[model samples]
Target: MGTSEFMLAGLVPGIAQTLDVSLARAGYLTAAFAAGMVVGAPLMAALSRTWRRRTALRAFLVLFIAAHIAGGLTTSFAVLLATRVVAAVAYAGFLAVALTAAAGLVPPDRTGRALAVLLGGTTLACVAGIPGGALLDAAFGWRAAFWVVALLCLPAFAAVSRVADTPAGGVTDLRAELRELRHLAGALLLAALVNAATFGVFTYLAPVAAGVAPVPVVLAAFGFGCFAGITAAGRLADRWPGHVVAIGGSLLLTGWIVLALVPGALVFLVFTQGALSFAVGGTLITRILRQATGAPTMAGSYATAALNVGATAGPVLAGAMNPFRVAAALVAVALVSAVAGRSGRPAGPGRPSRSRRR
Candidate 1:
């Protein structure tokens, strides 16, 4: 799903040419997917509140696979765009359910590690999937990439079908869930701000690193950093969640500021910036989940919604502006929120205090 969301950027020229649409029009596919995710996360979580985790997972996977197949077979741009949105919605539901299920599988203290393991697949996708799709497109045309995604879903479907059914977590009342979500608003806002900073600069990485290094090399470095950062956060977050986020945010803020002042250092900065960005991001997600014990079923949706909101807004906010400068400013705000909002507080309206848990 990560590949499907990001691969479109590389294939936009081909898609535009084949569909006889302008590049600007073809770009809408990416935006459409982000919008779908933002809208679908909470909506699907609420709608599937009565379903077993296994059932929700299987159903969404089917939708995702079917959408990919339909997209691969379509020639009309409008049809293709519709398929992207459908696939994104399915992906959103699947991700939310998967995260909730993953957390449920672990002991409370190990939640961060479990979430990290699940998110590792997405980070790996950044390292390999985007480039792999580009290669597939180069060799067999853009449609081939979509077909490959559909084929990949088959094994996932088979694997998910084997898991024993488990009841969905949290209260079934939609109003209660919404009220829980409100308590989590501060963490969610910080998440959106952090991602906006990370992705805003990332959206224009090629131009940002114009003379410093080639695009593929820069991307590989950045992806590797993301993987490393998340791995480290998985181990550390359980012990010192606040410190992880704070230190990562500090590094991210510093990195972006340096990039703004010293554009020549982009080749090196990209790797460090990627590490810090995802380190902070991964920690923030774990924090939100840990704080959301009261709204376990809706926890994943809250996190997903926050991320998609940032992903959708970042590039738009950075448009025609100095991306590095914009990223630094955004990170500054996120850091302040993290501190002022008391992101590391042990309890909220629906949660048990650390002392109570003990």
Candidate 2:
């Protein structure tokens, strides 16, 4: 699913040519999918009360597969955009259900490990799947890459259907989750900002890399950093999560600075862009999930929605900014996390602060 979601990154040039659109307009392909996830995540949670988790998963998985095929076959840009939206709906639903089920599949002591494995699977997708898809897109055409992802989803569907059990997540009160998100205003704002900064660069990496290095090398580096960063985030969250987030945000800011200073220096572009990718895809993703501590049933959907909302906005925002100026958003992310970490510090002798409890 992660692979499918991000495969468009490498294919931007090819897609732009195929659709007769500008590279920036081609970016709307990503935003359209994110738009669907924005709506689909919450809708799935609301619908889950009556739907069996496994059945819903299977259904969504099938829809996702079909949507990819349609995307691959379409020549019309509008059709492709519509197909992406449909695929995203299923993509969001599958994630929401799969994550909810994963937590219940283990004992309380092992829940964190179980959830980490799921997130790791997603990171692994970035490491291999998205980059590999990009390679295929470069070699063949973008549509051919879409077909490859469609085929990959087949085994995933079969494996989950055969091996996974359906765990019924109790009905999540939507109103309550909204209240919790409001209570977590600072965290949610940070999550959106981080996502916005991350996507702003990523969605434009194709054209941006053209001005810097070989497209393949840049994509591979970006994906590798994403995997490593997310892997580190799990370890960080186990100990000093607040500190890690602040540190990640600071690293992200540095990455943007490097990009601004040396956008075309191959070595620096790879290193700093990779680092920026790491912070965005890894720790920031975990940060969004961390904020859902107050709402279990709505946690998966809420986190997904928050990120998607930013994801939807980022590409559009990037479209309007000079790539060099994209760094401005990361500066904001760094400052916000610094403030959050300070607030999370131990407040008194016996009592911990709200962020510390997180």
Candidate 3:
């Protein structure tokens, strides 16, 4: 699913040529997927609330696979765009359900690690899948990449079938989930702000590093940093989520500022920013899950929505202003938000404090 979501960027030129659409129009396919994720996360979670986790996951994979196949075979740009949205909706629901189920499989103390493992797939996609898709498109065609993604989903479907059919717990009421979301508004906001900072800089990274370093090397550095950050976050977040957020946010803010001030350090700053961003991001996710124990079925959906909101908004925000400076400002706001949330109240009503949890 992660591969399918991101691989489209590399194939946009080919798609535009084949469909006789403008490059800008072909780019809408990416935005459409993000929009679908933002809308579909909560929508699909609500619709599938009554099903077993395993069942919901399988159902989503089926839809996702069919959408990919349909997209690959379609010659009409409109039909292809519709298939992207459908696939994104399935991807959103599968991600939400999978995260919730992954957390359930682990003990409370190990929840951070479990979430990290699940999120690793996405980071890996950035590091590898995007390039692989490009290779496939070069050797075969753009449609071949879509077909490959559909084929990959088959194994995922079979794997999900073997997982335990855990009941989707917690109150199934949408009203109840909304109430939980209110209590979680602060954490969710923090998640959005941090990702906005991350993606705002990342979307413009190639141009930002124009002469300082090769694009491929700069991207590789950032991807490697993401992998390292997530690996460390899985362990640290379990014990010191607050500290992780504070320190990671500070580093991210500093990295962005340095990049803005000294454009020559673009490569190094991109790596540090990526590391700090994902570290804070992973910790924030664990924090949200801990606070949303009462809304187990909807927690992942809320997180997905918040993250995609940032992903969609970040590029638009960056496109309007100086990307690095904009990113730095966003991270500063996120840090302030995190600090205020920590100093104010507990994560949510009836949740245990960190001291008590330990």
- Where does model 1 exceed 4 Å of error? 343-358
lDDT of candidate 1 vs native?
A: 0.85
lDDT of each: 0.85, 0.70, 0.86
Residues 42-113, model 1: lDDT tens digits: 889888877899999999999999999999999999999999999999999999888888888888888889
Which is the better candidate, 1 or 2, if ranked by lDDT?
A: 1
lDDT by residue for model 2 (39-76), tens:
99878766774566677778888999999999999889
Q: What lDDT is obtained when candidate 2 is compared to the true structure?
A: 0.70
**All predictions: root-mean-square deviation over Cα?**
2.5, 3.9, 1.9
lDDT of 1 at 13: 83
Error of 3 at 262 (Å): 1.1
lDDT of 3 at 325: 91
Full candidate order by TM-score, most accurate first: 3, 1, 2
Q: Please give the TM-score that candidate 2 achieves against the real structure.
A: 0.80
Give the TM-score of each candidate.
Answer: 0.94, 0.80, 0.95
Q: Evaluate residue 227 in candidate 3 and report its C-alpha lDDT on the 0 to 100 scale.
A: 75
Better of 1 and 3 by TM-score: 3
